[model samples]
Target: MSLTSNIADGRKKKRRRMKSDSDISRPSPMQSHIDACVSFKDKQVAARVTSDAKMDEWFVVKVINFDEKTKKFEVLDEEAGDDEEGGVQKTYKLSASCIIPFPERNDPSGTQEFPAGRNVLAVYPETTALYKATVISTPRKRKSDSHVCKLTSNLLCAYLRGYLLEFDDDEEDGALPQRTVPFHKVVPLPEWHRQRDLCIKMRLNSEFGVLNM
Candidate 1:
């Protein structure tokens, strides 16, 4: 899918009466009790989608459509020729748990430039799969002349400069070495995880009487 097609201006389109899928619509009671959270229609975030292969590989997808009533999402694979045979981008209907949302870039917790040692999901080199990576360096500005998008030459010159990342699974001596991934291909963790983590930390602090200090 084209970038423009994937990113809309937040104007609501005509609502489609989505039907609830029995399997994905409701989370198990135990799962709900483990972590109760709220869902938002306004969550503007990209998603990491498991490929058709289900081989632990994924591609970054925008234009996320979540149906709270059904607890499911309709995500578009923005990668060109991502369809089965290589023609156009493909769409997938998946359960809520299947979609992993990226944190908003405007979150007050951090800026687009993630600090060194920050954990992130980044696209592996020459592949659509995303992997956990540790930021070794902040992004640097770089120039580009690629005409992939419909932008002026001057405007296109400022494509993102990928930061240095050491993938988590690369602990072995001959694993994929540290590499760079453009800003567009990297993203922070979802808000739900961040909230849960903070809550856990606070609970631990309270148990230790650290909060009373």
Candidate 2:
């Protein structure tokens, strides 16, 4: 009777543990929706991921191609200089993580969802506006991988939402103008490519173009 009782207690404990595990297996509602959208879009991005699963700061992923018809985003690894000698080009496929909602108007709380977060209007004043940005990061092929392939502005934007501001270079000493254009812009992003000459170059339509950002 004693042995039987002990065995029954062990089974009860195992059942409790299994219940806990099942609870953890469920994904959040928002996360589940985001996953569905990305899976539908078939998009991807890249990032300089550390071995310990941390993202480096101020990196950008250049979007080489996008197919609106197919609703997919194509990404490529940005490289520096001419590799007259052969070198491995590192790139990843990614999809949008979330769906971007249409802009809202006349809300008591004015928050845009695109650029996202607070702009550093004045370090002294400390005023901000909120915005929302849909970000994309690549997933590792391995099922048990611990890290995402890229880091994105989604987290920062969420934290700083409703406090976005713009900085004036004229007022700032040694401040450079911000780039806002795609391909020509020098905005810091998740996949960064550094060149020794400080000249930014991109390949568009099988041709190389250089721009000073």
| Per-model lDDT | 0.60, 0.34
Cα-based lDDT at residue 5, candidate 1: 63
Query: Tens digit of lDDT per residue, candidate 1, span 1-213?
Result: 766765552222312212235547778885673333234233433454554533545566654555556666776776678356577877776665555555443332333667888887787788767877888876533444366434533322333445689997776677757788776567775565457658978999888896577
Please identify model 2 stretches exceeding 4 Å from their true place: 1-34, 37-48, 51-85, 92-173, 181-213
Q: Give lDDT tens digits, candidate 2, residues 25-131.
A: 98878667555544433232232322332322112344555444454445444443247635655444444421122112223133322233323111112111111
Model 2's TM-score against the true structure:
0.25
How large is the C-alpha RMSD of every model relative to the true structure?
17.0, 18.2
Candidate 1 clashing pairs, residues 3+ apart or interchain:
none
Q: Which ten residues in a row have the lowest lDDT in candidate 2?
A: 133-142
